[model samples]
Target chain A: MSKQTVFLVGATGETGESILRALLDDGSFEVTCFIRTASAHKPSVQRLKDKGLKVVFGELSDSTENLANLLVGIDTVILSIFAFDVGVEASLIQAASMARVKRFVPCGFGTPCPRGGVMALRDLKEVVHDQIFTLHLGYTIIDVGYWYEISSPRVPSGKFDYAIMVPRNKVIEGGTAPNMLIAKKDVGAITARIIKDDRTLNKRVYVCGDILTQNEINSIVEEKTGEKLELTNETTADVRKDLDQMNRAVQDDPSNLAHKYRLSNAQYNLSKYVRIDNTPEIAEYLGYIDGRKLFPDYVFQKFSDFVNDLAAGRVQRPYPHVSL
Target chain B: MSKQTVFLVGATGETGESILRALLDDGSFEVTCFIRTASAHKPSVQRLKDKGLKVVFGELSDSTENLANLLVGIDTVILSIFAFDVGVEASLIQAASMARVKRFVPCGFGTPCPRGGVMALRDLKEVVHDQIFTLHLGYTIIDVGYWYEISSPRVPSGKFDYAIMVPRNKVIEGGTAPNMLIAKKDVGAITARIIKDDRTLNKRVYVCGDILTQNEINSIVEEKTGEKLELTNETTADVRKDLDQMNRAVQDDPSNLAHKYRLSNAQYNLSKYVRIDNTPEIAEYLGYIDGRKLFPDYVFQKFSDFVNDLAAGRVQRPYPHVSL
Candidate 1:
């Protein structure tokens, strides 16, 4: 069979880069990535181009006709842009549909943001999902929950700037609420495998590395670090109170970036992270018998491996993407 | 006491125009309506300006700094813009907050759109609500359900061009499911009264004329028009089936506007119109004991009155705003 042509937007971003690398390594599809010319000088863009991947330069808000022209003959269009660029992402969806792309994957690689909570990004993601549904594009939404790199305090990636689940010396909200977290590279591999899979078409797929509580994560961190670190337990109510204060701070100084950061972190703690007891229940909610059971052929990386990678200095400590 | 300086956005649109008229007639608030200069030559703008109404020309995406400067003395900001202008609305919310406006009333004049449900506009409204909540802006969300002028079949307002409730000879879906319908004028009057009322601050309010089924609306139309219209009953399941077909049609030919119209109408039938037995339950949802019991002093125009007004050529059947 002839190889399918895939167009990926935001290929320089963390999620985009991971997915792009995974797809390229698979060598089954002809991969093309759209990058902003403004960031063409970046080393990441040069690295991707050097890896024998096709690269195109354009703004996210490129005219629909122009975007459609670029998407010509592409079988799938995967948008992995920042959630805040919802308008741009919407335009891309329209353009992809206009170009008659058979499949479209939006940047929904987290919890299902069904409603707007304190996080504007989550709300915007919800809006994007709505737009995709209304446009009736042949789409697949991947809700992979949180990533381990940011949540694991041992690594303390720049992306985890919000002290959500710091390895030590942090208060974990709802410490015992079993939550799902996947390694970022694993997300890339899973997405690459599913892009052309018919089962994923017009559906939402939930994937994860491990399902464990914050306290469990803390235990894992201690085992890897070989040192005891301070850990505090905070109730959900305490987190909400902080969110309320952050909300006020945002209102008082709308331009303050720190207040926005605090508000974002507070919201993620209060709503965005999903807590599922077991794989079966989560799989049921995701419209499957069990995600792991369904994908028996694929093996996800373990949290211990992620911890070892952090200790060995193999994991990227400073995330290149903008903080959420 | 000096009148509150109210900055009104989209004051020339259907709901906005109605609210503007109500506020002007009351002569309580010093009303200022923001209008895009591209539409400055429109007769609506001229008419408002002719009536000594303060008209400011600017884009919705005018930098927040510029918008804040314009809103320096405004006590409240009321946004009744088209639902499709969500990006613009977000900018307005930020601008309003930056301006330190005391209260904000977003374009939540219809049903409450809590999440994305096959409707992009509803999802956008949800995002706007989230933005308002996150910003900690003092706000009032008015869920007035459906407007009688548009939803009533005998009067086919241009705004209801999507064939939701048509002028006779149409199958009404879920005819027995009760819904709250209010006159557009009443929405304006009620909103005008509540803009400055402390009771409405930071809360959602549901106001309605009558809670009745589509069959009842058809009966009222027949009673007023003195003509027995050909009406047929259809189930919500039938509507969902049509929506599914529309969804497929849109996927097949994404640019087909007709498919979009069909999908929009089907979604409206399935979700937009409220289904309730009585006012008290709806009141509970809107956080009130009972809307009627709470607002005993305000008299909402009856469905019979609406029908008579339509038959007597008092109701403006050709809506000035674009169709949803």
Candidate 2:
């Protein structure tokens, strides 16, 4: 069989690189990555170039014509890029469908939305996912919940106090959500395995770490480092109420447009996925990850794109940049 | 009070021109007519130019940077351009608000979609209008119900052979639902009048034509013509059901996206303000155009734009472009 060209968007991010690495190991595929920003001085991007992967840099809102060129012969695509909760996903997916790309892997590193309370992920998702299904594109979503990488950045020990930003304030305090800390490599392996597995077609699956509930995950932190991790549960609901209030306030103050947009996006992304209790699912994926030998890509392209967006200044104030 | 410099979009369309003429007569506004298709033909644009109006040509797409110049020193704007249900209206309104234009008028030239049960129109009203209000743009809607010029273009001739298109395809040979007919000129007048009237701010007002109940319209036709005017009243229910069915069919057919857009638009325009069993509000604005007056400069501006659009092929099959 001829080798397939799999276009991976957002290949320059820390997590996206892992996914790209796994896709590269597949003998039957050649991978191309789309990035919107590239700094030659940046170590990660230059390293990616050294690996000999094709990288095309362009904005996320690139029109249909530009997309048609990138999609011309690609057999499969893994979308890991997103905007700040706008109609970008649906628009990009529609463009890809028009370009006749064979299969699409949407940025679904969370529980499936339908399995949740039919709550909208973002306003765009309400409009977009419907557009995706209605457009009749063959799609598979990588349901690898939240990434530890984004939330758990390393800082000098005791130099900085621990503070975690939750979607809003949660029910149970201190990390009640299950977080099976699957090594990045394990996440990578699962992604690569799915591309080769026909059974995963048109499906949404979980990829996680250890079988750990929110409490267990916190315990694991204690056990590993012997330093108690400060815990916080931020319920998405409280955040939404705050955002709704902010939106009302914004109507009276045009100056608050950006802030309202940010809050709304936060609420949308946090609530978009299936409301998995996560303890069982995280354990299940953690077991699966432990059983695997080689690392698989965790489909971190979207996160990677998020990084490029920050580096290029398309988006001001990253989550890390925001104090509150 | 200083006169406001108003920029009018789609000033050449039926209602748009009316709005322009009304504003022109009020003597409190300086109008800049936005001409989309007259880029190369300055003399063609000169029809408005001769009347001492400024004209600028460009596509009305959301990202048209040229609009920045038009927005400069522009105190108010009237957007009348329509695309086959695209996402540009709110984006443009936001742009206007950002430019600090004091007042904006939306192209709400139909039975207020709220009263009308057309889904596409309803969707447009929700998404577009909500976006406008969010932008904090002071706006008004000229809620004209139906165009007399667009329907039954030639009045009942002596023979009364002219055909009328109704939502009901299977009505009894002679049933009558109310037919509210406003000439294109009246639509323009209502649009023009809305922007100038302080009472119109933050409000939507209905513009109706000579309101004759279905039987009255047919009888009037019979009175004017030597032969009996055929009377057909498709019950509002049957017409709505048919329109809903057509809307679903059009939405499903991707290849016919543009055509479906037009059909749904027509269905929306025709279904509303049929005086289902009550008062037709045409009486409110009937006095606005008591006589066929001179070639109002604004009306001429519209005619000129239509000629330009026709010549430039911009008038390609309009949505619901009736074959009649």
Candidate 3:
């Protein structure tokens, strides 16, 4: 059988890199990375090129026609860019539609929250989803909840050095609500499987390695590292208060970088920890196919295993820390 | 004060014509109509041009940069196009943002409905709304419920000629819930007032001439015409069943024109008659300023007056009949 041809954007980003590596390792798909011309000289991009991956340099600001021309002959187009780049993603979706690509995997790799919430980013992502759905594009929307790489507290092992991942070891309301977590690498593997599976076409797929509350995750880490981590508890009301303040600040001065950053952080915390709508049951209610159920035999790395890796210094933080 | 330079799309459309007439009649704003080159030779475009209206020929499919160039020097951009032209509207919004237009009025001149409903068109409009808000473009979303021109029952008068306006004299579910209604001409006049008023900036404005149930409207029409029009009542459940069937048909064949038309008709019925979420209280709850409250002294044409005009063969249907 002929190999499936894939075109990917944001391949240099953390999630995109994981998907790229997984697709490459599978050796069953012809992968092409669509990197920005500005990022063409990046070592990460160059490394992908050296690995025999096809590279296409273009700008997201390019005309839809131009983007469509570039997407010609591609069977599937996968977007993994930042959620804020809605306009870019919109243009890409239009371009993919024009190119008559068979399938489109949009950038929605996160928790499943209801629309019209305090999270402005989710609203933006909803716009992209509506565009793809309304255009009747063959698409697969994958939400892998929170990434396991960023779900852990800062340990004494020093391997996971991102302080912003869990600020001050503060967990929300004891984190009693079950939250879905997936390793970043597993997201790529699951995405690869999802795009190729006919059942996932035009549907939302929920991929998760484990479903554990923040307290459960912390307990697992403590057992693995043999050290108790001091934790601070914050209520959802507190998060809501912070979110309201941030919303007002952003509304007052939308162009202020500091205000925008603070608003995004509050929104992220609210979505990841404060909200209790990230469980498998919520995913089912939202009409998401269970990835674990779909691939029952495929073993997924648990939170404990990730904690072991962090304590053993075998894994490192995937993204840099941006101090709030 | 200098006249606000206004750029308008869909000037030849029913709602656009109303807005264009209102803006021109107000004599307080300088209006320029952006029309498609393909429609340049139409009588509507020529008639506008003859009235000393500035007409710019361009297509919505034009590049964002090209559209932005045309929007230069315009203080406000008004979109009165069809709701289905969401992609076109998004590009125009981008261009408006790029051109630094002070305010944008999106194409949402209809009953106020919540997002993510069975009405796909509402979802499409939401996308445009999100884009304008996310881009930090100053925007005013105006929703003027059902148009009075089509809201009335068909009388013996030959002036009101559209049969599709209220097909078979069918009304939904006893119609006890108050539904907002506004004259098409009033929509344009209200929109003109809304754009000029500083209060409506970055807000949603709900314009209504009357809030009456279907039975109330029918009684008003019966009194005006001195003739009882035969009416058939349909329940909300019946409309929902039709909507579901149409939805399935559209899902099976998205490109089928018949299925699309049926789906849209069912959705329109559901939003207009079946749904009770279009009242002033609902609008206020949804953060919309009441247009009637904003301009208390302004005389609005009530349903009784509209019925009288229809009986006297004064007002004509703005839109043509599309057999469904």
Candidate 4:
């Protein structure tokens, strides 16, 4: 009957920040953010501390002993950190298990990685998931296929400074894959609810604000903004081919840090948008059924709702650059 | 055209060693084995060197500049290393590009890693594939689904130290998924041919010795060996559930080296046998069609031929523990 003490990693990013706000607003759980000590001086961290959020200093890549110390007395650990080493999440999971955290949620706020597909980001998720599963820890995985902000100018990851799949003037050719896009705020709210709801324990939980196709999204943008953005007719195959070429280029010149960054961005984008064939079956496969059927009591915010919110300026601009 | 030069990585491995023998026997291409400097003292490396095979000492994880130096004047680079760091192959790829190696063959002699699947081995393959593609390097991906040695007592990879799927007396219950398996010798022969044939450039070259379901494979063992192994009635679902649990255990204690090894073996076995549903379409998808029909010129060693060879003591008993 006691309030759960929450330890949150990746508290500075958009999703992490949103989740933090939701956890604080819930007023039932005690929230603590585990951030890198070096980045603790950032304004965002300062603001969170000012809001009475407990901020712990630690790096995910740190030794398990140190991470365990950080997770002590924390009932739940929610990770929203970006991918670093493949072992980072595994290390955190080890620490949480040592500390005996009641529930652990590793960052999965995307599509369910295909069972045997290769995609570094998705594979990293798999590695972490394998470690979590092997450890017999109580866990929850959130699968939000894509973010609407991918189509917005202000990027959350900040690696890709512009829109990827659905930029202002360009839509991928045959952009009809049913995109299960979720808002950062919705992700936060839903995650907070799931944390409170014990039913989601040790299971893969699905969260999506709306399921919209690229063509449908393009049309919605036109309606909302009163302009037709350039809809480029490049296919998913083209993106994959180009990704392959660019990656080779990176290999050719390991000194090209810019190309490596570009490769990373492309890899992330391809995993998010191009890898999975866009189909209703895929949407249904990626927890659309579970998201709707399991959480019958909760109403999800729709893509239209998000667009309407954006059009009415009821919400802040879609993508806000979050400082480190 | 001048005789092509091949810089082969992992020449001491089971498949790598076989490929090396075939390439040497061909006498058309100039074959150079790029091995780790640390492994230069291994008997296998010494034997290859004794055979007048060019054994170049350079680790795949070496710097691009150094690897480039090792790959200088190499016409093609073929990687046959086991799953290791994602960057190792990428580093070699960078070197190959720098050295202007005309063709690069990555290690993908297994089930196709689904585009966004979480399977770690497949994901590693994906990572290597991405680097190859992004670099705009020439590539020939050989997807040989599974190896027949999984049922053989003589395992190639000494780490597992035992037959994984086909234990002496057990069979997965309802094991009906058709496994597309190939012989290491066939793989060697076909690869050598592919290297000589310019038609296979930049294409996904499929190769299969045989495709058989677990039930069929079990029956074959019974017929060939005149012994009925205990047919354990475990389902794919069971394997997956157990994998999930075992993975959780690994997460709980990341330092448990045995657990990590078991987890890796479990992952590789699951990807090879359990993950994909045994549908005819999937069989076609994993290169069965192209392997069986596309290359009429190449005759693959059949499963029957392999069993007969084993019966006659023509093929060396599998799972030979080669000293490093």
CA lDDT, every model vs. true structure: 0.71, 0.52, 0.79, 0.68
Q: How many angstroms is residue B129 displaced in model 2 relative to the true structure, after the best TM-score fit? A: 1.0
Candidate 1, residues B147-183: lDDT per residue as tens digits?
8866666333332233333353345554666777789
Judging by lDDT against the true structure, name the best candidate.
3
- The true-versus-predicted C-alpha distance at residue B42 of model 1, in Å, is 49
lDDT-wise, the better of 1 and 2 is 1
Model 2 chain A: weakest 10-residue lDDT segment is: A285-294
Model 2, A188-273: lDDT tens digits are: 55777776665555444565554334555444434444555554445566556666776676677856545655564444334421
Could you tell which candidate, 2 or 3, scores higher by lDDT?
3
lDDT of 4 by residue, B8-37 (tens): 888888678778888887878898888788
DockQ (Cα-based) for each candidate:
0.09, 0.01, 0.02, 0.03
Q: How many Å off is the CA of A75 in candidate 4?
A: 45
Worst 10 residues of 2 chain B by lDDT: B285-294
Share of true Cα-Cα contacts across chains kept by each model: 0.21, 0.00, 0.00, 0.00
- The docking category that best describes candidate 4 is incorrect
Candidate 4's C-alpha runs over 4 A off are: A1-324, B115-118, B152-168, B252-261, B277-280, B283-289, B317-319, B322-324
Taking the tens digit of each residue's C-alpha lDDT, what string does model 3 give over A151-190? Answer: 8887655545632254336788776768899888888888
The predicted structure with the larger TM-score, 2 or 4, is 4
Model 3 TM: 0.54
Model 3, B1-324: lDDT tens digits are: 899999999998989989998998999999999999999999988998999889998887888999999999999998888655665676788899999999999888987776666477777887677677545578888998888876776655533554325443677887677889988889888888899988777778898999998889888877776776777788989999999999999899987766887797788787767656667765654446778888888888888887777766677656563444
